[model samples]
Target: MSSSITTILTKKSYPPIGHYSQAFRANGHIWVSGQIAADADGNLLKRSMSEQAHQICKNTSKILQAAGSSLEKTVKVTVFATDFSKLPEFNSVYNTYFPQKPPRSAAEVSRLPLDVEVMMEVVALVDPGDEAKL
Candidate 1:
């Protein structure tokens, strides 16, 4: 038996700088790639932790949308940050996107692509009817 995999992309989000889809949909789930604070053109942004978190969420949202999912459907999220002390700042913005507060794990890392302060990846359910359209 074989399954179909859909590559998700959106011009509204930061273009992938590397050879990877923004997200992939398969088996009723959308796996969004780790997103950083970058603009649509892929220029990394210099912003406060809260602002960066918001941008990352927005970028993730666009990718999810392209995959026929949304942040509200997110099941899991993993965050990597260069500073733990700014977690409060990141959470403040994160709560706005995920009011239900899906399961999440976070860790302080030494560095990330482009040295952005934070990067986030998500896994979300594919909307029932939307999957057939893929």
Candidate 2:
């Protein structure tokens, strides 16, 4: 048996503080592992659910951009929050990043790392030729 998989990996901006990858690319798609509101140094960026969600989006964007892609190319997203109550606040911030709205789902988790309130992950198919923006 043989495999021709090209495992694209990046560890510069984000390291596995937990058990995850900041981002990886292969084939024609880039799979961005879950990103929290943590800095490159793996420190949680303190902010409200609104601010935290924004930071999470911003962080994800950076990882995508590093891989020659952007959120506009994202086809799917999943958000996990400690409570459904924070979702309202998260939405206010989420809309700021995704105005056009792509495929998405939200989950209420028992807890998140550092009790950070909210976290998110995304899947994106990128085309450097595409001019569409989100």
Candidate 3:
């Protein structure tokens, strides 16, 4: 059960607040960390739920690219929302990212770091040759 592990890093994505990589690659999979509505510069986007969701998804996309993957290759996704009432808004924005319907789960959390409205993370297949595109 020996597998090589690699930490994915990219300046085009937001820096991890703690001791964690934006994503990890091992055993043919890429596991991205939870992404909030923040840009690569770490500036939080404090806008409407739809906007926040869009930013979160965009952040995920960037991390996926940096990890030698893409949204189309995503196998699973988990979304954390502070307000269940805004699920529709979140879904509306999320649909634009995964129109093909990748497996996903959404949960209403008590709160998220920085008190953001939405956060998302994803798991996708790793394509080693895709690294240069990022």
| 7-37: candidate 1 lDDT, tens digit per residue | 8889999888888989988988999999999
Clashes of each: 0, 0, 0
Q: Candidate 2: which stretches are off by over 4 Å?
A: 1-13, 128-134
TM agreement with the true structure for every prediction = 0.95, 0.82, 0.91
Candidate that scores best on TM-score = 1
Q: After TM-score superposition, what is the CA distance of residue 52 in candidate 3 from its true location, in Å?
A: 0.9
The sequence of per-residue lDDT tens digits that candidate 3 reaches over residues 76-104 is 99989888899899899999999889898
Candidate 1 stretches with Cα past 4 Å from truth are none
Tens digits of lDDT, candidate 2, 1-134 = 11123333444345666665677665446678777887767777777888788778888888777666788888899999888987999899888888879899999999887777888988887563431321
Local distance difference test, candidate 1: 0.90
| Error in Å for residue 32 of model 2 | 0.9
Error of 3 at 69 (Å): 0.5
Sorted by lDDT (best first), the order is 1, 3, 2
